[model samples]
Target: MMFKSQRFFKSLQLLIVASLLILPLLISEEGLNSIISTKAVFKYSIFCFIFLSIHFLHRYLLFPKLYARRKTILYFTSLLFILAALIFTRPFDRLMFELRPKPNQVDAPRREPPHSTENRPPMGNERRSGPKIDVLSVFLFLIIITIEVIIETNKQLSLTTQRAISAEAQKTEAELSFLKAQVNPHFLFNTLNNIYTLAIIKDENTAPSIMKLSNIMRYITDEAGNEFVSLRNEVDCIEDFIALHKLRLGKKTTLNYEVKGFLDAEKKIAPLILMAFVENVFKYGISNHSSNKLIIKLAIEDNILNLLCQNSIYPDKKDTERSGIGLTNTKKRLDYIYPNKHILEINDDDKLFTVKLTIHL
Candidate 1:
């Protein structure tokens, strides 16, 4: 489609040039008659053929092979050689002179003063008049070269821009993949630790916890690699995560997990985005000696989704700098996928830690 449009534009430009070349001859009756003559027709045909051949030769061969390859001296030298050849050939000189109408003869001959021998200018009929075909040919050649140079320069710039954009996109994808790889293993290690605790105690729910781990792993394997997942599926994963942690919660520890608003299957979110905060709650907020409380709420209204996780901080189970890998990667993922579309706020006080996240879906 692009090639066809370019060809059409080139044809239109050539037609306009041809029309301008012949316009002066079309103005007078005798000039019009000269145009229809067999000799004049043959001359114009040859002129047009030569003009088109030069145009195509420069566009496809000369410019691409020499000028585009940085052979500047050679390219201009070739153009100058072509210009000299056209000027010496003088192809349109006779054709233009023949098409010009001859001046009308006077009915009575002008009578010179009998005694006046003063020199007088020659009559219009005796004067030599013709188009400056060499000058015109040089001007036309310069115009063609100028146009080709501008076009090729613009084409190279556009190709460079496209390549830059492609490289940036690939870089972004690779970074996101690396971040996700870091997150998945970190998540698996924590879940396996929980299962190990249950197995040591020989709790009745140990087998069920293992089964839950299997389901969670299956979801991660199947859908976590995708850029977005159904919001409904993500919510289900969060519920399973909470259930698995409940088995290991101390009697004094309290967890209130609630979901408000309708969850549409059509709505989607970045996979594993919310899990990091949830995992942190279990890691650093649980205690058997101290009374601990964890509150998690997710609400959706209109196209906005909000998550709030507030937990009582236990000094003995408090997270260290090295244990923040999941949250760090999650923050990076949000910047990559959501950019300015999401807001996250974390507040840590002596007694409590709170996380608030809002996303524009």
Candidate 2:
């Protein structure tokens, strides 16, 4: 949706600019046709074509290679040479417009008596011929150059603004990653401590717990560094996290994990984006009683990721120290990366904590 909107606005901007540029041509054609002959209008169009060719070349090629690179001497020199070439091509322009009288006619005998009603050919001096500089062409050349410079300036400004926005987004993402980095070690230490406790007690689950921690750490080290990863990977990570917690809490906790609809590995989402809520469920929802319950549902339908997490909370068992930090960082990352492409809702009452997130892939 964000990309579509950006593309639409760019297309609209180009359409508006094209319309504005063509408006003058339409006006000139109509006004010139009314004031001058059709042949004169044709000459005007050719004149415009020449000016456009020069404008495009200078704007796209010469300016970028010379003027934009601060080669002022070469740039000015080339522009002067172009102007001289146009001035020297006046004879060719006149020939193209069929404005030149025949050379033979300049020295030929008169076609009719001067007093007769018949039309007479123009005398040699009456027709201007050969390399006559056109002031109008020069005027139009200057106008085109000025207009192109303004357009180029606007284009440069737009590019600069886009670059600045991209840089700021990268900076924000870096900050988010740093915050997320802090959470990784904290979670890892807690999981490791659990494994150590199991090892000290000589529990059979200790070896498997170490293996699970290793797998989870691999995912964290590899996928967490990226801005996005496959949704399948995220799901697998969540399952591993749930399994790890199950080993720790055992029969004291009940975790209901359900995945509905087809999962596409091709679809991607931000890494560690959904895990904070999953981690929160185990952190606060785990209790040494049969009544403790954690429900997690991940559904994919029509390229949308719907994640729903609900966990039972007791008044005296809350861990408020790390409660909001992960959620805060996750929200900031969502705003930075997904922008308008996602929806997140959190509901917390006395008995339960619920989080629902919808992401458009």
- Predicted candidate 1 versus true structure: per-residue lDDT over 180-280, tens digit per residue: 55344544676688889878988788898888878777878788878899999999888988887776677898889999999999999988888878878
Best by TM-score: 2
Q: Whole-model lDDT, candidate 1?
A: 0.75
In candidate 2 the C-alpha lDDT for residue 305 amounts to: 85
Which portions of model 2 show Cα errors greater than 4 Å? 1-186, 200-202, 250-252, 287-290, 314-319, 323-325
Candidate 2, residue 210: CA error in Å? 1.6
Q: Using lDDT as the measure, which candidate wins?
A: 1
Residue 57: error of model 2 in Å?
36
> Each prediction's Cα RMSD?
15.3, 13.6
